[model samples]
Target: MGPTDTTHTTPLPVVLAGARGHGSWHLANIRRLQDQGVVRLAGVCELHPLDETELAAFAAEPPEQSADFGSLLDSTGARAAVICTPIQTHAELALTAAARGVHLLLEKPPAATLTDFERILTGVRDAKIACQVGFQSFGSHAVPAVRALVRTGAIGTVRGYGAAGAWVRDDAYYRRAPWAGRRRIGDTDVVDGVLTNPLAHAVATALELAGSGAAHDIASIETELFRAHDIEADDTSCVRLTTTSGLPVTAAVTLCAEQAGEPYVIVHGDRGRITFWYKQDRVLVQRAGHGPEETVHGRTDLLENLVAHLTHGTALLAPPHRTGAFMRVVEAVRNAPEPAALPSGAWHTAPALTGDGTRRVVRGIDAAVAAAADTLRLFSELGVPWALPTEVSSP
Candidate 1:
């Protein structure tokens, strides 16, 4: 099973499920890889066939397009499936692909609940198919470099880590999808909060940096969830994950920022620290006795990694098992109390950049979020008068 293995010399046949919305990225990526002879987009499974506008961009004769996913796989004989569907549909669609012995590239925040996640994991394992979870940041080369620095004692004894993300999302963002900003849809748990949804990469990458990817690695979780928007989920949130060894990883994030900045995670050791801007695949390292060093790293596309794994003996970077600790965070958010709304006085409204409507700006949120991450304290603990104590429990 080496790169030179002749058994997999040809490009892998693949299907693109949910080929609209976020799946559109996959469609374009697949087309790009197809041109390089790494993989072939053999089929597309969508409720409706891609319209002329979407189809026109295909570089080659598009494969079969159909509404039935299982049928698409069988008909196209696709060996792999990339699923970028809704959060709730993930488990069922993934199971469908796994039952056919088709490998998978499932999107992030893997499933709606632990039960669904387990079901998908069990099915994929039983089928003996390679399943790569879609946390694209996991494929970033900078992530491993930082981890290696920590393990090599470049920063000394790891004290903990912190992450902060501030971004703006207007009414249109929530209106874009039915599940937007929802914690649960009927009996299903969406847990679409700021920490779990939009800024999840920061949280997941932090957990990975902490060397705590399994459920057992986590001892407890403390969550502070809030919303400035009229949605069912939190638009602003913070979480502290305490590992079994008592080290902490705290993250503060918001979708209703006065001014948006790049999201980042900082690994704080006793003598030094490392800051990683996950989106840019950038890293900054500072040790106790050395001047700071910064590096911008490249990323491996998850789809490309999946193809490599199938064609060669490459390891899947973001597998289901590696995301257990993250799913635990999702489970905690699901079981936690509803996100409290920020009082009107705590935030003011202003016209959004597009001049279409208004946006909520939580007063002093930027400083408050940074303080929480830097001090490894929750919002309430940081003396934010309007902030409430975090809800603490084992995840």
Candidate 2:
């Protein structure tokens, strides 16, 4: 069939594959699309059998088939698939979907390696299908507003930026999932950790807001992985990067602190600073000579925007191509140097195990000891206060 003929005749039915954490979020987005009559929910594909809770959840607005990915696609006749699998499997799943002529909504860090990501990109291009990457913030209101300001010179000649936040994950968190802090996916030594996974969104969002893409110069990036509880990947990281335009950006992420929330980005230009809190969905613009900062709430209409773009030919706020650039930054961070070892006797002491409930207190102490040891090892092997590429320079 001809391109236009194929596009017009086929109804875009979406099958959600690998409905895990972010996959569940994608399912919600799919439901939103169905409610708005933008697309039909064909089925769900997950490796494990659905439990009673999962079955009941789906029964509310059940799909035609909820089975293995290939079976679900065959049974439901879906025209597209949204893959939210682990980082290691992204390339394979995306390539499979492309081969089947299915549109894709792939989660971020497109693949574990540059080669894998490029292969998926080539496949999607060859198939001539719509492929949307899950860099949700790109569709947020704050991104567009900041981009417009930067583009129009409202933030006169952007120079540098800074971002920091405390990311805290406890011992039990790592034990809960096998892939919690792992760099290698199965046997492949893929960089699948905080920088590539958790911090990917912020990195991409910052680049988009700054109106920059892949760095022309070798953008330097450094990372540190800590085992708060014997996990394989780094739980905390501080990264500094320079854009092709010479704008320096710094990002700090940690899963070892107990903080309420993290500050997002602070973009500095000749004119002023624009600060955004992602979790809070708030933006504050402070101009050079301005007395009071102007605040704007970021848009909560990301899913609707995605649907509108796919169904009505509307312009996407964050197209997949732009999203791909962000993934490149994620790769750079993953490739950074491992942190230096920590000195002996420079560790935080645990609280005494003296309480009325002696047994419980003792158990807690044991857990704390284990966690501390793990953290120390992580820092020693993978430096705690690690520096990014920008922090190290030639004299």
Candidate 3:
């Protein structure tokens, strides 16, 4: 890992901030791209330096590591940075990278609040550098395919959309870091809820499939937030949106599932429906006059897309502007009251097979989550026994 490759023929040198937690995935991905001659890991900004064991994958040319992010960027001359830091730090770090004219592959939930989202969105727009938010599902080729199907009336006329995510997270999962499940730390907002962070793709994808991925595209939103965990943020939640086009969208997600399974977004139409398991880039279409049809579409990695966008004039996917509508959802979750804790009998702890820790299981959550996506209804609307009253976010 070395200085920025100013020549277009050379690979872009990229620095990574927050090398622990979710950043580890970015580290391995960087190594893969480095092997492909797409980019170089120029430096790492971690509070504590990653030792040889942690840097083993980069043994051939270990990147410089430092605690001071700006200094590391200046010293390494990094042309781009993949930021997977805590939610509250995104705006400042993005501005810092922008000030240096460095491109960004910022992680999901790009900001903790609308103010910060707007700040970073404006700074990067003014900087005019390629800034791809880390909502990787947007890079799925199935996105266009699904959109094309809807446009051609492959699903007849579009009615609405829904998404479901049911994943298991044990008690230890929330203890992974100081900010792991916090909505706010002191006066700063973190908003690391189920919809805002871990399963954010479900929310953003449902909105995008409706051709409404901008701030103005969202006419209004209604949210139902709940948590089985002892932490501040919601581990189980859902949101319903009315787009400017009058299309309906909903996302139901829970980290307290009976079992972990692939998350998906579905488009509902009068004559048919299209289901996209975004993680696997898989799609299934079912309608009248035909049997069920399924296809696995190829996906474009967001970071790789950013590199190609810079070097080959390719279109940028998951750009900041493309996530404005998602930010509105984040804003709503932020202003909503703290997640209502599940009553004692509504959830029970069960030990995980892998032995990480005991997981909290919300009774019938898997079916409830799936039903919301299948019917475009929230948990309460579906009459789940433990659901709280819905909270509406003003337009």
> Against the unseen true structure, what C-alpha lDDT does each candidate score?
0.86, 0.59, 0.90
- Model 2 lDDT, residue 294, Cα: 62
- lDDT (10s digit) by residue, model 3, range 198-295: 99999999887888999999899989999999989999999999999898899999999998989999999999999999999999999999999999
TM-score of each: 0.95, 0.79, 0.97
Global Cα lDDT for candidate 3: 0.90
Assess the local accuracy of residue 122 in candidate 3 as a C-alpha lDDT between 0 and 100.
Answer: 85
**Candidate 3 structure, TM-score to reference:** 0.97
Candidate 1 lDDT trough over 10 residues, lowest sum: 1-10
| Worst 10-residue lDDT window, candidate 2 | 356-365
Model 1 Cα shift for residue 282 (angstroms): 0.9
**What CA root-mean-square deviation does each model show from the true structure?**
2.1, 7.7, 2.9
**Winner by lDDT:** 3
Cα error of candidate 1 at position 203, Å: 0.7
Q: Which whole-number lDDT from 0 to 100 does residue 193 have in model 1? A: 88
